[model samples]
Target: MKLVNLYPQKNIEFFTPDTSTKLKLPVVTNGISAGFPSPADDFLDSSINLNKALIRNKDATFYGRVKGDSMIDAGLSDGDLLIIDKSLEPKNGKIAVCFIDGEFTVKRIKIEKDVIWLIAENIKYKPIKVTIDNDFTIWGIVTYIIKSV
Candidate 1:
């Protein structure tokens, strides 16, 4: 699996949401069929191991399928998988996956002296400034981008 740099030439700001609250993630297990009587046990084991390796260092990153063109100018298109890491601290300029007012969105974070803003790369979309009353939450920092060709 190759990781692509989505925003290579652009300088984007990053932000971290207050993660003092605990997050509960559900555990998922890959189920195996017991009725298969093939001699491909070795192959199956190897495949599983490979899958694990591809995602081992990436356990901290959550996968979310993108749904809009707001980030297209930044090279993030619709249906792309975003690798977001919540443990990474948000900085001045980086792409991040944020949850605001019960909705999840991928945007570039900008931190001003007195305000935080969520910026969209597309001209058709408007930038969102964080307000005191808004339910804003920065879910994670986007570390890698995976797109389908």
Candidate 2:
């Protein structure tokens, strides 16, 4: 809660696996076209376990619920479920869930020559430049985002 207060926006959560639950859903193999409508292919249905589709390293993967629109342009809206992987290295232009001075934040990684900036996609929020005064660590790399319709 303290971390959420400090960040004001970007309240992120860490997910733990629930081994008791197993869910398998049907997936269509063909990619849907955004520009045109196409007939549904009933013959192209395959079962997909979410855990197998979304997760790579079970020990390093976690989920976080986003709480703000700072990343709306990046397609991460408030209340979106984020799949985070701690094993992935944080690279420039990758979205990352970061911990700074005991606060949690989700932002895009911007690597300058000598500075690292945590950038927000929305114009209302400014990029955060990491300095020696701040305590920062990249918690994880965001792999997928699930938004509610």
- Please report the candidate that would top lDDT against the real structure: 2
TM-score of each: 0.62, 0.85
User: In terms of TM-score, which candidate is strongest?
Assistant: 2
Instruction: Report every candidate's CA lDDT.
Output: 0.67, 0.83
In model 1, where do residues sit more than 4 Å from their true spots? 1-59
At residue 76, candidate 2 shows an lDDT of 96
For residue 52, what is the lDDT in candidate 1?
43
What TM-score does prediction 2 earn?
A: 0.85
Clashing pairs in 2: none
lDDT tens string, model 1, 4-122?
Answer: 44333323322222233344433324445588754543442222232343233444655556778999999999878766677788876788888787677889999889888999999
Q: Write the per-residue lDDT of candidate 2 for residues 4-60, one digit (tens) a residue.
A: 222234456666654335687877788676888888876567778887778888778
Worst 10 residues of 2 by lDDT: 1-10
